[model samples]
Target: MQFIDTHAHLDVEEFAEDLPEVIIRAKEAGVAKIFLPAVDLPSVSTVLQVCRDYPNYTFPMIGLQPEEVKGDYQEVLKKMKKILDASFAQSSPFIAIGEVGLDFYWSREFEQEQLIVFEEMVKWAVEYQLPLMIHCRKAQNELLHILKKYKHDLVGGVFHCFTGNQNEAAEYLKFDNFVLGIGGVLTFKSSHLREDLPACVPLERIVLETDSPYMAPTPHRGKRNESAFVANVLRQLAASYQVSEEIVASITNQNVARIFGISV
Candidate 1:
């Protein structure tokens, strides 16, 4: 059974010393593809290089993470868009605009800035016909509010690291095209995700992700997350839905392909 880490920071420095080993281990664990979403301008080149090195096994997306939003965001977004255009002209375009959205968990210091940048990035998705890999923390209401304006324009995307309740999950499901990205949090003993997720979302509207170098599943909790460990999250989801791991992998892989338009 093959799996896809719909979202992972595979190009970050955390894997710098032994990225090849990580890729090998991921393949051994049945992870067929890993999507690298950029957090800032610096990450553009890093994600590009890693994706170029691995070719189809790894892919890239450019966007300014909400938490990373601050002064000079305009300049950063401009440069990122330029790189995206040039890269697309030279080769296949990026799959999405993501790992981007609103985060109010830490502080509201940059809330306005985050909203502006988030909307701009969403516009890029609409303009380029790319999907979005969204991240939200304590701000789903705001995120959904903005997306409502693009009811007809936005193609689709994954609501990465979704930790919301049934009602919230229902709201996203109403979008018809978007899916909830489930990851390591579901494996946490204290998390209500496992129980809540199974009953809240249908298998068709869900996808798998590691959000690697972070959100490592149980057993590897509190450690650096890697793509291979995504299998743990897959196992957790399978158990939650009372289905086999292979079944979970197959459906999520199909869902990932539908969202990104890339078959695995």
Candidate 2:
């Protein structure tokens, strides 16, 4: 069965020593496409370089992660804008504007700044007519509020590592503008997702992701994740919905392609 990892940090330092091996393992595991999400200015070059090196496998998404938003965020924004502007000017293969959203889990001090940056990025996505990859933590309500306001403006996107309740899932469905990114969290025995997700979001509206170098699935839990481990997520999802793994893989792969305009 073919699979797509809609969000991963393969360019992060964790994979620096053996990225080639990681890619080989992913291919063996049937992960046909891997989307790389930019976390900040410093990592953009590395992200793009990885995509360039593995064009047949890796796709790129450009955005500023919320946790990376700092006091000098304006400078970071300028850098991101510059990179994006250059990509458009050069017709670079950036598939979406993403891994962008609010995160109050870390520090609330930059809450206002993060919101401003998020709104700007949303505006950019609208202008480019590209989907977004959102990251939310302890700010789903606030993220939903902003998403509602710009729902009409956005082309579409995904809520990476979605952990919201059923009502929250319903809100995302209302826009038909996004999909819930299911990852290792769903495979956890104690995860609320295992109980809440299948009843809430339909399988067609879900996409698979590993969020690699993090959130490794159960049995491999606590280890650094990679796209190869997406099979575990697929297995758990299929079991939850009482379907074959191939069916789950095909549906989620289609969902990722439809949302991000990538192929597996």
Candidate 3:
């Protein structure tokens, strides 16, 4: 059974010690493709290196994470633009613009900056004709508001590690340009995703992710996560939908391919 991890941070330091073994384990567990989301300027080199090392299985998405948006955002954006321009000239090094969105859960100090940065990245995605990988938190309504303004420009992408209500899910569906990312959270007993998601979004509009080194599924809940652990999320989702894991994998794989414009 082939599977795709639509969101993961394999370039993070947590995987630095044993990245080779981790990749082997992921392949052993049936993960055929893994998408890496950039967090900041410092992470770009490492993310690109990972993609180069595992060219057949790993792909990179570049963007400034919302939490990283700050007073020096103008400088950061300049650096990001330079890298993006250089990357585009060499090869289509990135598949999407993401791990980008609004996050008010941490602190609202940089809220305005975050919004500005988010809008700029959205425009970049449009100019490049690339998809977006959104990371929204307490700012869902605000995020949706901005997305609505640029709805016509969006080429669609994954709402990475989605955790929202039925109404929010409905709004995302209306955009017709995204897929809700299901991950380890679905394995939690109290996770509303298991109970509320199936009723709101079609299975085809769902994609699987790990968001690794965080949100590890049960049986590995407190441990550092790896791409291989995505299987646990697939299992839980299959149980929730009352279907075979193969079916869930197949549906999600197709969704990932469609959104990322990747062949799998």
Candidate 4:
């Protein structure tokens, strides 16, 4: 039962000392690939280094995370685009433009800034013909509005760390080019995803993730998450669908491969 950890931050400082063991554990646990999403300009290099160290097992995506979008976002965006352009020009392009979107959970001080940067990133996705890896917090409505505006320009993407309701999930599915990225949130006792996901989303429209060094599954909750724990998400998703874990893994692996243009 091979799988992909669709949205993990292996380059985060939390894993600095033990990233090797983390990848070993993930490989041992049947994780065929770990998708690394850049959270800011510096992360572009960090993710690149991690992927370089594990060329066959790790892939990188470039973008500034919403929380990091500040008054200097224009500069940040330029730096990211420069890296992406150089990579493409050198025949070494990233697989996606991601870990990008809007997040108002903390503050709306940068709302407009985030929106502009998001639109730019969306254009980057289309320009590169790469899928997007989106992150959203309390700004789903605003984010959805922006997505609708550029629906024709999108190449599809995953709504990573999804925390939406049935109706919200339904709205995202309308894009036809998107998928819900299910992660440790699904294993939380209080998560709405437990009910909404199985009831509202078809298994094929889902992909597995761990959001590593962040939302580790239960028993490992509040602890550092790593790629291997995506198996926990796979287990619960199977329960939600009343199927075996292997079936869940197979379906999700296909979804990841199809969406990100990678094979396990």
For residue 29, model 2's alpha carbon misses the true position, in angstroms, by 0.4
lDDT winner: 4
Q: State TM-scores per candidate.
A: 0.97, 0.97, 0.98, 0.98
- Tens-digit lDDT track of model 2 for 147-250: 78888878888988988899988887887758889999999888888878889888989999999999999989999999999999999999999899999988
Error of 3 at 223 (Å): 0.6
- List model 1 lDDT by residue over 216-238, tens digit each: 99999999999999999999999
Give the alpha-carbon lDDT of every model.
0.90, 0.89, 0.90, 0.90
Error of 2 at 170 (Å): 1.1
Lowest summed lDDT window (length 10), candidate 1 = 84-93
Each prediction's RMSD to truth: 1.1, 1.0, 0.9, 0.9
Location of the lowest summed lDDT over 10 successive residues in candidate 2: 255-264
Candidate 4, residue 207: lDDT: 94
RMSD (Cα, Å) of model 1: 1.1
Candidate 1 lDDT for residue 183: 89
- The residue pairs found clashing in candidate 4 are none
Which scores greater on TM-score, model 1 or model 4? 4
lDDT of 4 by residue, 24-139 (tens): 99999999999999999999999999999999789999999999999999999988888898999998648888999999998999999999999899889888889999999998
